[model samples]
Structures are given as C-alpha cells and as structure tokens.
Target: MTQLNEKLTLKQIEAIIEEMSIDGALNKLYAFKEEYGTKVDKLIVKYEKKKLQWEKEFKRFEDMRRYEKEAYSEGVKYIAGIDEAGRGPLAGPVVAAAVILPENVFINGLNDSKKLSEKQREKLFSEITEKAVAYEVGIVDEKIIDELNILNATKVAMEIAVESLKVKPDLLLIDSVKLDSLKIPQKSIIKGDSLSISIAAASIIAKVTRDRLLEEMDSIYPEYGFKKHKGYGTKEHIEAIRKFGICPIHRVSFTKNFTL
Candidate 1:
C-alpha cells in the first residue's frame, strides 16, 4: 500500500487517479481511505459505482455484437444490418438503412434507436456514418406507402437501402423482417435492434434520416408539428390533421380513418 499523503486534497488525488489503471486506482483509493477520511471513502465508492456501470455497458455492447461475431465466424465478410423507420407514422416517408460495420467495432452507448433520446440518436448517427464501412438509406414516400401498404413499402425502402450500399454486403442481418426483394443471404432476428449492434446502427441511421425529413416537412406544414412528433400520431398531430386537413406528407391510407 503506497501511503498517500494524509493531507492530499481530493482534487490532487483525483489527478493521481486518472494516471492509474482502474484496478490500481481503486487499490490506491482504498489504501488512502482511512488516512484521507470520509471524502476519500466517498471517492472510492463513486469510483466503484462508475466501474460497475462501465462493466455493464461493455457487457451489453459485447452482447449486441454477438450476431456479427457469429456471421464473422462463418467466414462472412461485409455483413450488413437492415432496419427501417417511419413504418408506423401517419406522415412522411418510410426510410430504411443498411449499414456495414467493422467487425468488433467499439461504439459506446450504441443500442436501438427507440431506446435512445433524439440527441443520443443524432450523436450516434454521426459516429456510425463516420465509422461505418458503408451505409445507405432508402426513402419511400407516403404515396407509395398508400399504394403498396406499409409492410410492402417498408420492404421496398429496405431493398433500396441494400441496393444503394457502396459495398454490397455478403450477409444481411435484418430486424424482425426478411426482404424477399433482394436475393442477399440474410437472417432476421426478432427485436434485432436491441439484440444486434449492426441493426442498432442501422436503426439510428434510419431514424435520424426520417426525423430530419419530418423536420423539413415541418417547414412546409407548420400546423402539423412534424418536427416535434416526427410524423407519429400524437394527439397534437391528429388535432392538426383534423383542423388543417391532410397535407401531402400525410399518408393517405393511414390518415383516412383519422380524417373521417
């Protein structure tokens, strides 16, 4: 036990903590606790809590990558994850994203887009696009959604996303739905956005793309508050539709019941 100066200020000790390995820091902190008193004890506790939290995050991240690992183990290269956004929305286009991520890529706080805040999604969106091997988005507007129905429209968007990828993926890991439009070898996982990091990355890209589009639509249809709800059928948006009538961005098939 290296004897830390009994009088060392917490700020000074904190600086020392940064220089040590996590285990070394914890040991050093523990050794100093009695001499430095209660504040030092609190620091030890805080450090432990932080360490535990980090462990949880790392485990979750590793678990999220399991599907990618499986694919990689099978001699697969260029595995892409597919996910879509705006399928349930009453307005705007259904957008899908296909993202190929580097094997064992470490991205902290990566998860399903629905599980993250808008700010988090936006941040991860930038991180993913920057670090991804390749990524592409497909957008199918409300008119086509009405024509083909949401499920088929979503498939088309996903097909477009896969087709547009700069690097064609050798394997596709999709979220809950299979794409028959493309003949790419694929696996679908239920709630895959939460189960697979690749799907989560694709989810973030699809969500951010669709949200930005809805925000752009907000400028055109100010009364609908598209930016706030991102085309979801919030009461505010429903009220706006009832009052202002359906706009071009509103899915005719979806809003028909609401309008009536």
Candidate 2:
C-alpha cells in the first residue's frame, strides 16, 4: 500500500475517483484511510459529495420522465415532446420545437429551459438534437405574430414543427397547449416543461434556437439589445424602443400599449 501511494500522483488519484462508482469510491476511501494523507482524503470527500449530488440529480431526471414511461407502458411508440419559446416577447419570432426522444434515453442535467442558465441550455440543446430520434423547429416571425395573434401564431408554429418531424410520433407530450388540429394524440400538462423530460428537451431546443435568432437580429438592430434581453420587454428593451421607435421586428400589437 505504501508503494502504491508513492506511485499515485494527486492527478492520478482524482482520475481514479472520477471513474469509480459511489460504492467503489467508499471502499477505496475506507481501504486507504490510514495509508493516504490529507490531500487524498480531501479528494475522496469531494468525489463522494459529487457522487451523491449526481445520484440525486439522476433520480430527479427519472422522475421528470414519468410521462414518457407512462406512454411507453400504454404501448405508445415514438413519443414527441412539444414546446414554444418567445410567446410573450415584445419582439422577435415565437419559435416552437418538436422532439422525439428514444425510449430509456438518458442525458444528464436535462431540465426545464427556464430553470437552467444560458450555457446549460445551449449545451443541452446540442445534446438533445444529437440524441433525438427526430427534431424540427418552427419559427413565426413578428409579422405573422401580429397578423395571426400570438396564440394562433404559436399554435401554427407548433403545427409546423410537428409536421416537419421526419419521424411520425405516436404521442405528443406538450407544455400546456393542446394541438387539437393535429391528428396525433397529445396530452398537455400544466408546466409540463418542469414535469416532463420530453417537454423540457423541447423547451431547451426552442429557447436556444430563438435566442440564436435574436442574437442575429441584434446585429441588425443593435439599439434594441436583442442579444441581451432576447426580445423580452425589460425596462432596458422598452427604453431602447422608446428612444429608437419601433424597429421592423417589434410586434406592433404587443408594443401598442407601450408609449413607443
């Protein structure tokens, strides 16, 4: 054991801890408790805490996928999750996403887009797309939003997203909106983004996609700070609109109440 300790560097110890399961880590901690010094002991404590947190997070993730598991039990194959972003934004388009994730799909750190930071959402967006059986995005610009009204425009976007999916889903788990027009069976859960893995994945995809579009729009309309607020009606955004007047992307209907 002393010889083994001499050969193991701090980096090597950390690497081993990273690869070990929680049980294995605990066994190693016990076996080397007396043989290792403070540095290794600290590493073990850190890894143990991290492993416990990971276990808790994984449990929550499984719980969030209860809707999907229920659908699977009902013999529904190819479950699609649908969600929309930018519905309440004062500018930019409302974007919707439809994603069909495979059964027993596991992606760590998946949660509601609103519950995550921009970096987390961006990372999950790529991960979801890579793992999804089929995914598609539908964008309805401010012009269409003004013409159709935000509610109808969002529904249209959702319809377009579902229709564009390469794979036909047997069931749709939606975030508080039923697509009655679509032939596919759907269940809309209130705040489904927080309760359903599929809806959460769809939320992340829609949010990331809309944020990207707003960033591009920021280049064209730097005054409104689309990149910063992502078209939300924050005081800064409202101030910008008031100073610059309505830009092309501003939904006239939404901003009509605003002094601008």
Candidate 3:
C-alpha cells in the first residue's frame, strides 16, 4: 500500500489508487470512492475522474520544475529575476524585486503576476520568500518616479533591489529591460515572468511589496482609494484625486484627471 502522506505526485497517487482497486482494497477504495456514491462500478469511474484532476495539477508543477532545472544549468548558480510594479500608477511607490530561489524549490501555478488573482499571488508570494535563498525589494517613491521618469526610476529600483540581495546573482533574467551598468551577464526575456519561474517569482515579490506600500498609503491618504486600486488611476481614485488634489505620494508629472 502506498503511503498517502508521502509527497507523491498526483499522477503517482492516482496510479496507486488504480492498483489498489485492481487488488480489491475495498476499505481504501471506499474511502476515496465515497465521493461518487455506493455503487461499486460507479466507484471505479469516480476514482478515474478524480485522478485526472490531480494529474493536471501535477503536470503543471512538473512543467515548471523542468524550466527551473534548465535555467539552473548553464553555469547559473544564482539566477535572479527582476520585475517592477506601480509604474503606471498616479501615486505611491514603484517597487521592484530581485529573487534568487532555491535550485530545487518548485511551486505550482507560478506565472506572470498580472495573470494571477490577488489571493493566489499572495499565497505564492509567501511561499517564494520563505523558500528563496535570497530576496530583496526596492522602492522608488512617486516623487522620485516623477523626477527621474518611470523608465529610469524603474531601472534604478531594480538595480537597488539586485544589489541589496545577500547572494549576488551571476545572471539576471529580466523582463524587457537591460541593465548596462551591471557587468553581470543578463538576458532580457520578453514576458519573462510568464516564461521563466525565476522571473515569475520576482513579479510576485514586486507586486506584493508594492501592494503593501499602497495599502500603507491608503491609511495615510484615506480619500485616494489606494487600498482598492493600489495607486492606479481607477474611476474612484481619479474622483478622489480630483476632490483632494495630489497628495505627497501622487506623481506630479502624471496627467491624472485631476492634479495639483
């Protein structure tokens, strides 16, 4: 009998269930089979259906693991992914993250931060930080973003986050931007967060960090709806900005519907 508590892939668990059924482990079979009903023949079918669901989830993680291994090779011991959030927002800080995850750490359903729901991202964000070998965050405030322009400010923030890391990465996997000053080898992968696990991890970190900052801003500027939209120029945010004018965190350079 296969141990259910062991960390078996969903596929493996399904296989064990099938084998147990073939040998007529009724107690074990009935335990899982109860989800379907009491009919013996129906139970077999139910097991298959449930097994398929697990297989899909298992495959998702397996694919992610394969990519991590590929990147881990090529002499890249510490491959950090870089990404930023709050660039287009009219207020709050621009946040960036540099994350060097463990070589063997595998988390399911990690992808571009934009594609994930807030709940999913929050869960994965915690997992990444706990499991990563080294991680760092950089924040460029609204005033600085306005003064330096978003592109340059984003670059500065990214560099700061990377430099802040305790483990200096040998290679940088970035999303659509290159750092010329950092002599380390780098690859600017277009939509890297979707394609690379490391980049996806960075995206999650940057997003969560920036969201926390905006939440804090929300407390300070209660009228701006920073907590809801995280400083983005939504309808409510625009209305609030129009009513309140730009606060200390608002980007003066941005042409919000209403500005000081």
Candidate 4:
C-alpha cells in the first residue's frame, strides 16, 4: 500500500498498479481519477494523454516569451500593441487599447482576447494591468463611425489610444492598421492580436472596455438589448432600430436594413 504522503513518478505508479489487482489500483487512483471510473491501468494512460496536452500549452507560452524578448531587443523601449473592438457592431463606440507590458511580466494563459472565454479575458485583463508598465484606451462613438466609416474610424480610435498612453511607445505593433502619419515605427500584422502577447493584452483591454460601454448603454436603451449584442446588427436590434428610427448612437450608414 502506498503511504498517503508517498509521491511516485507516473511510470512507477503505473507499474505498481499493474502488479496489484485492478480493484486495488482503482482504489489507489481515486485521488487522481476524481470523475472517471476507469481501471487503474486506464487511468495511467489517461494521465499520459493529459501530460501531452499540457506540453503543447507550455510550448505556446514559450513562443510568446521568445517574441516578447525579440521585441525588447530591438531597442523599442515602450512597444504598444494596438487593437480595436466593435468594428462589426452597428452601434456603441469603437474602442481601442494600447498596452506596454513590463519586460519581466508573463501571464500564463494570455491569448487572442477573442479566443478567450469572457471570464478568462476578464481575469487576464486585471492581471495584465497589474503587471503592465503602462496602458491606455480610446473610444469613438457610432456617430463618428457612421460619419467617417468603420475603417477610418477604427484608425482614429487606434491613433488616439496610442497617443493617449502616458509612456510614448518607440514602436507600435498594430493589428492590421498602418498609421502613415504617426512618427513611430510600426508593424501591422494581419493577426497581430493573436501572435503578439502585447497585442493580445491590448485586445482584452479594448474588448472589456467596449463591452462595458455597451452594457451601460443598455440602461439607456432597455429595448435594444445592447448588453448582449454589443450593438451588433442583430435581427432584434434591426427591429428596434426600425421601430425607434435610430438613436443618437445608432450608425446611420449601417442602418440600411432598418431605414424606413
């Protein structure tokens, strides 16, 4: 019988279980196989599978760290990652974030903010800010989006977010938008938000900030369900816009389906 405090390697544990009855192994593995009722031998195999899964995650984090170091060595002291949210939405503000992460900071589960669960994004958002050197956000209302068009409006939001940062960045890692007017050196990667840790951090900030704005707008327009849709051109939202004939925040250019 293994002592309660006895720690064994996975292989050693499996070999011990194989020498004992399946029932004995099952009883021994109860601590590890909490939900699954597989035989001890099967549990050992399951552990191997889980180990491989975790290894992949470890590699991903390694890659992110490598890239972070490369960005730092380029002599770009404050490299801000810029990204925006609410571009596809019909209402609400287009929000952007610029994050300057600390050189030594590393968060375990950082990824594209869109790929993360809402709870995960929220958790990382806090962790990133607490560990970041500096961060800033910018927002442009739907009125501006409609007047300037989404593409230009998004650039406007991104520029403002970058300029607003207390720590002026020497380099910008933007997600697909190039700022020709800005003096700083910039890299516009198509999916920069997914590849760059700084960009992923920025995405989380922008997403949470924009989502909260829509949630607050819900209080003003209870009938439109802004909190859930975040002002996207949903069927229900289109119906509301049609009946209400557009609110101050509604993007008139995008309301073709609702225009009466």
Best by TM-score: 2
Segments of candidate 2 deviating more than 4 angstroms: 2-4, 19-39
Question: Estimated TM-score per prediction?
Answer: 0.89, 0.93, 0.80, 0.79
Tens-place lDDT digits, model 2, residues 12-75? 8667766777778777876666776575777777777977898999999999989999999999
Q: How do the candidates rank by lDDT, highest first?
A: 1, 2, 4, 3
Model 3 alpha-carbon miss at residue 225, Å: 0.9
| TM-score of candidate 2 against the unseen true structure | 0.93
Q: Of 1 and 2, which scores higher on lDDT?
A: 1
- Identify the leading candidate in terms of lDDT: 1
Per-residue lDDT, model 2, residue 105, is 91
- The pairs that clash in candidate 2 are none
Q: What is the C-alpha local distance difference test score of candidate 2?
A: 0.91
Off by over 4 Å in 1: 1-8, 15-39
Candidate 3 TM-score to native: 0.80
Superior by TM-score: candidate 1 or candidate 2: 2
- Provide the overall lDDT of each model, using Cα atoms, as 2-decimal numbers: 0.92, 0.91, 0.80, 0.82
| Per-residue lDDT over 29-91 for candidate 1, one digit per residue giving the tens place of the 0 to 100 score | 987776766778777887898789889999999989998998899999999999999999999
Ranking by TM-score: 2, 1, 3, 4
lDDT of 3 by residue, 193-257 (tens): 87778888999999988998888878888887889999887889888877778888888888554
The collision pairs in model 1 are none
lDDT of 4 by residue, 76-177 (tens): 677888899889988888999999998767587888888999899899989999988899998998888888999999999988998888898888888988
Residues forming the 10-long window of minimal summed lDDT in candidate 4:
32-41
